[model samples]
Each structure stands twice: as C-alpha cells, then as structure tokens.
Target: MADGSDPEYVAYVHGRAAALRRTAYLLCGDTHQADDLVQETITKLYARWPRIGRVDNLDAYVHSILVRAFLDEKRRGWWKVRLGVPPERPAPPHPGVEERAMLRAALTRVPPRQQAVLVLRFLCDQPVADVARALGCSEGTVKSQTAHGLAALRRILGNPLEIGMAR
Candidate 1:
C-alpha cells in the first residue's frame, strides 16, 4: 500500500534505517523513543519524498529533521518536569558497554539542545559550519554549544581522554 514514487527514497530508507535508528537511539537514549524518532522522521520524509529525493544529501536532511524534532520536543516543555517514569533496565554489559553506558548517561544529563549539538558534532562527525547550517544557528552558537557540551560531558565522564581531540 505504498505510492511507489522515487525508488531511490525507498532504497535509501531501507538502507539507512539501521543507521538512523542508531543515531536516534543515541539522541533519545531509549530504544522505544529511538524507534519513535525514526518513525516520525520517515513519515515527514515521506511527505516530502519528491523534493527530498531529488536532493544530493538526503541523509543530512533527515538528520537535521531528527535533531529539529528533538529540539522542538524539548521546547514544548517535555523535559521540563519529571514524570516519575521508571528507568528501563539496561542489558548485560559487554566489553565496552560500560563506557558506552557512561557516555549515554552523560548525554542524558545535558540539555536537549546540547545533546543535539554533541551528537551531531561528535557522533555524526559533522563540522561546526555544517552543524550550524543544519541547526539554523550561528557558527558562534555552534562553537559555544560544542564547547559547553564537551565540557559538561567531560565533567560527567571525569574528563575522559583530553577534552576534544578525537571522537
């Protein structure tokens, strides 16, 4: 029951779902919320399929949408108050699981805007200019956000491995 227009869109979504889901999972720090994020982004993408499908950087467009969506949710006061929701039990630890878990916990401690900035810059390997453009912010804001986010992450993670040299 699909419109079947733009085979490339279909192919792109199929191929990139896992990657997008991983990014979303990192952004939201929850599997169910990550799934929701991907679903919402794909739905928006479907609505703009013809136009977005013609763009050379569809992945970037989708990522921008996801980040914007997360920011919008935060602005609407979703994270303003605690809802007393129980934390989901994490899976058993692997070799690097503890490190990753610590990172995720550190990420969740920051504001959503900082979280978006960090994930896009660090996790997605995007440049400051690209991140600023994608987030519709000034390059200075991107720099400040990157600095503060990195500082906060370091403080939370006990200054892990020299602030910001490599990911």
Candidate 2:
C-alpha cells in the first residue's frame, strides 16, 4: 500500500482523471501533452488538497488549475520546441474522422485564450458565467471570445457551412 494514502483524494483523482485528460487533450491536441498537463494539474491539486477540499465546486477549481497550467505552458518559450521532423501520412478515410481532424486543425489556429474559451463553452458545456469565472474575465469577454474564435475557425476552415452556424 502507498504511504499516507488519502482515500478521498485518491477517489477524487480516479473519478476525475479521465475528464481532465480529455479537456487537456482538446486544449493541446496531443495525447502526450495532455497527459503531461493532467499530471501537472494533479500534482498541483494534491499539494493544495486541503484548501481545495473546502471549495464549493471542486471540478471548477481543478479545471481552473488545468487551464492556467496550459496557458502557462504556452507562455513558456521551451513549450514550442519541436525535436524532429514529421513523416508524411495519408488522410483519414472516414468522413467523420476527417471532419473532426479538420475541425481540430482549425482549432489549433485559434489564439490560446480563444481556444480555451471555445473549449470551455462548447466542449465542456459551461455557461458564460462559469467560463468567465474560470478564465478570470468578464462574461462579456467570454461571449466575445466565443464569437471571435468561431469567426477565426470559419476563416481557417474556409467553409462556414461545415461549422453548422445558424443563419
């Protein structure tokens, strides 16, 4: 058995780890980077477990930590370093997979703050108020970011129809 194991903390981590990983993956679009983000977030959570335990919304607190960590990583110059060239590969054959790939590629083109806003609003189904609180911005900012991010995505994708925008 692990020394000084806190059952509550262990259970919380177990239940939320997958969700955290998925959010991280959407933010970074790389499984390895997502894993790193989750690991870092969990470590920070563990260190502040006592304070975090007292929070009314644990999920939101953890998400805030995760998002901030991702933003911080992006701000660091070392995070942009690529070690090797990529090999060429054929496109996905399935339409669904291809569409998802295209969407993700377009998402990567968005600024980090806009990407975070879009992910939190659409992917996580968070309300504008919640997103504002998480990003430490006003609700108006979240709404504007969502609009700008969608516009940027449409431009990058070059097919607004494909994004299913309402007329």
Candidate 3:
C-alpha cells in the first residue's frame, strides 16, 4: 500500500483551507495566529490522511483539530505574555466608531477560552453538543462556559437588549 500523500488530500486541503482559517480566526481572534494554527492542523491532518479520511464526519474532525490547536497554542507561554494586547479591531460598518471600539475592547478583555466558547457557541451558532465536540469538553462545560461568557459580556457592555433590537 502507498503512503498517505495523494492528490485527493491536496484537493481537500485546498478546498477547506480558507474556511478553516476563518474558523481559526474566530477561535483565536488573531489573523496571523489563525493562519498558523490552520496550517499546523492541516499539516498534521495531511500526514494522517489515511486515517482521517476514514472518519464519517471529517469536517467536524478537522474543526476539532483546529480548536485544539488554538487552545494548545494559547497554553504555551507566548499567548500568555501577549494576552493583554487587543485583537486588531476591524473598521466599523457605519457610524458609531467609538461604540465599535468599546465593544472590541470589552471582547478583548474576555478570557481567551471564554472568547473561544462564545465565538463557537453564539457567533458560529453551534449547538452545545457540537461545541463540546469541537472543544473536546463535556456538553456541561460548553453550557457553563457559554453562560458565564454571556454574563461577563453583558456585565461589561451593559444589556444587549437595551442596546438595540435583537439582530
């Protein structure tokens, strides 16, 4: 039998790479770090493609890999030292630049793990079970983290309901 390297693996990487990068960005809140994390995860997956390809839910499997990589990277010393620095806030969609900046600052203050949970659970709109699967934690952990993250966000930014109509 041949080793795992193959054209189909290359095609799969090309197809999923951008989406994986975006998911990684949402997970880590840093574009550069996100790119690195996606690359690392894809490299590992590529090396084990024979096994990985056999999984029924390969997309979910890859997502789990990305999330684990982001968490692992943060556990290392670099993210710890750089934690205080805010993510590069994108330009506001319209007026109220100050408000956007304030929100970004508040989100930056959130714990990285909390931010990750919120992004995956709320922003990405993943269900608790799926989020738990991605985070490699129990569903209870996802639920608790989501609750705490929302509470902290509300405490920092004031009532989301008061801000405006629910989007």
Q: Candidate 2, which ten residues in sequence have the lowest lDDT sum?
A: 79-88
Off by over 4 Å in 1: 1-6, 53-56, 76-102, 154-167
Candidate 1, residue 109: the lDDT equals 72
lDDT tens digits, residue span 1-167, model 3? 22345777788789899889888877766789889999999888877787764677777888888888877766534324426665555776875775746655566556666777888886677888888888888999988898888788788787743542346
TM-score of each: 0.71, 0.80, 0.75
Candidate that beats the other on lDDT, 2 or 3, i.e. the better one: 2
Candidate 2 wrongly placed segments (more than 4 Å): 1-5, 76-89, 163-167
Best-first order by lDDT:
2, 1, 3
Residue pairs with backbone overlap in model 2: none
Best by lDDT: 2
Estimate, for each residue in 67-110, the C-alpha lDDT of model 2 and write its tens digit: 98987887644323332645223587866676676677667667
Candidate lDDT values, in order:
0.76, 0.80, 0.75
**What digit string (tens of lDDT, one per residue) describes model 1 on residues 1-167?**
22337676688789989998998877777899889888988888888886663566666778888877777776646344333765444775674666666667667777778888888888778898878877889999999998998888787678546433455
TM-score of 1: 0.71
| Pairs in clash, predicted candidate 3 | none
Tell me the lDDT of candidate 2.
Answer: 0.80
Q: Highest TM-score, which number? A: 2
User: What is residue 26's positional error in candidate 3, in angstroms?
Assistant: 1.7
